[model samples]
Target: MNNLIDELTPEEIAAGDVAITSELVPWHFPMMNDNVRNDAYEKALKAALKNGGTVLDIGSGSGLLSMMAARHGASHITTCDFVEMVAEKAKIITARNGFADKIQVINKLSTTLVPGTDFPERADILVTEIFDNGLLGEHALVAIEHARKHLLKPNAQLIPCGARVYAMCIESSEIYKNHRVETISGFDLSAFNQFSSYEYSGYHIEKSEHKALSKIASIFEFDFLKDTKDESVEITFEVTESGLCHAVVYWYELQLDKDTIISTAPYLPQLSCWKQAVQLLPKPMNLTKGETLKLVAHHDNEAIWFNRL
Candidate 1:
């Protein structure tokens, strides 16, 4: 996302107008609106439509993927999203791209859709951008589970066919400050850490900010096309540097197709819609270069928190 905080006036930020305007206009973020995401989608969609049939785009935001499917010679495309306003906007977007006849935008959850009524038939291909920071946080498991059981063809091609979350142990006092509330002007308020959220944050950790103590480790993986179950993951990584480790710096890789992959890993050139997400340690731990750190992930609903086993 662009650095709007620096551009906006202090009054706008204080009045919450900056946030309000952000929601009012979602198309401004270059992270999602630019060619980085679209290029990956185009390549994968073209490959999927080599022998095209009906394409189903779950969470088809702004109808871009549907238009891409239409361009790739799909017989028909049914794009669906739960948001009514977004669905309506998709209709207008599809029309502007001159795929109004080939694509239909439906405003309903994927689970509610039925064959022979809402859609003419089960989808031959399932294309969706349903992953979150941890790869499962956006109800992707439930959505894919429902689709495999009811909506998709027996052998449908699932775009972003799989994903894997990679994490590294890091020691960053600067990063910890965001979540930790210590004394401010001589008041002991460390108890506020109990109320601090463990949710993955969209924090941009610069290269200079954090010191990596361990090699990157893959914590979790999901294969969307196959029968899958969500579960917590445990990982152990050998520390490469000695330091005070404070957080798990994490990101995910998207398998758009067999031949294509997109990611938001640190220092990568082509990034996806997601920034890297971090899971802060409850307490800092000192470590050595040769020692290992064991990480146990606790998953509830779709969120994850990493801690010592």
Candidate 2:
């Protein structure tokens, strides 16, 4: 039998391991995007220090935000993650940055740790970098709500209190053709077209503006602090041209406050985990130059959601 320690990989140890009813596996593995995410954290930290309150980084991956909180002159700080390895590594990172004494690292989910109860004190500001392209798909709202209920003070601030999603049309003729399996060795292999339009992942498509394509829809934006947790949103978009509506390119801009805004959508210089969630519309809506494209964005109960046009 493989012991937990002996079975673990280096990445597993650094990312944080979790245990279910039957087995232990790594979870919340930190894939830090230094370009987009780190910059957002820096901006959020600056905003958080405006109030000069105690801070809590709900998912303190790599302790980057916690260290930023200390540097920004936060009075006190607590950082937690459900993954034990991540929390432990965050402590190391904080110590290396000379913030070990200012920030307390906890290895537990936000729900399991209660401020002024399990935690040392209530947090005056709750900061987290748990956002995905469309927000709720990553369960960012659920995590923030958990921290708000158990760990935050009466008027705690939420970083990126809200986010807006923008989407447009894209074409990938090569991608669709690559998935086509034709006759091989005198055998018919055309059955693979069934998955031809599966555009769940990101790809590098040469930027082009075909007159046949235009914005098809706008998905519902998310307000992390004010929206209901059990809600699924659907948005419809109109197609302005006639062509194969291959995919919907999505991006987001976050509103940290009334005055502070940051975006990582197309045309932005940096790319984060949100590298434009492309939804493969069911069929290439064959239309003329004036036909409208209708797209509906939906969020499933399990938090895995997508937009369709």
- Candidate maximizing TM-score: 1
What candidate 1 gets wrong by more than 4 Å, as runs, is: 1-21, 24-28, 298-301
lDDT of 1 by residue, 37-66 (tens): 788888999999998889989987778889
Q: Write down the lDDT that model 2 would get.
A: 0.65
lDDT per residue for candidate 2 within 1-309, as digits (tens), equals: 258767765655555443532133222332354445666667777876976889888787778778878888898888887776567778877876788789999988777787667668888888877765545565677777777777788777888678776766666555445544557789986676676645454542334333326753555566767645454455545556666766666666778766667675665555444555666555455655555555455554223345543
Stretches of candidate 2 exceeding 4 Å from the true structure = 1-37, 177-199, 204-212, 229-236, 300-309
Q: lDDT of each structure? A: 0.80, 0.65
- Of candidate 2, the 10-residue stretch with the lowest lDDT total is 21-30
Error of 2 at 20 (Å): 21
TM-score of every prediction relative to native? 0.88, 0.77
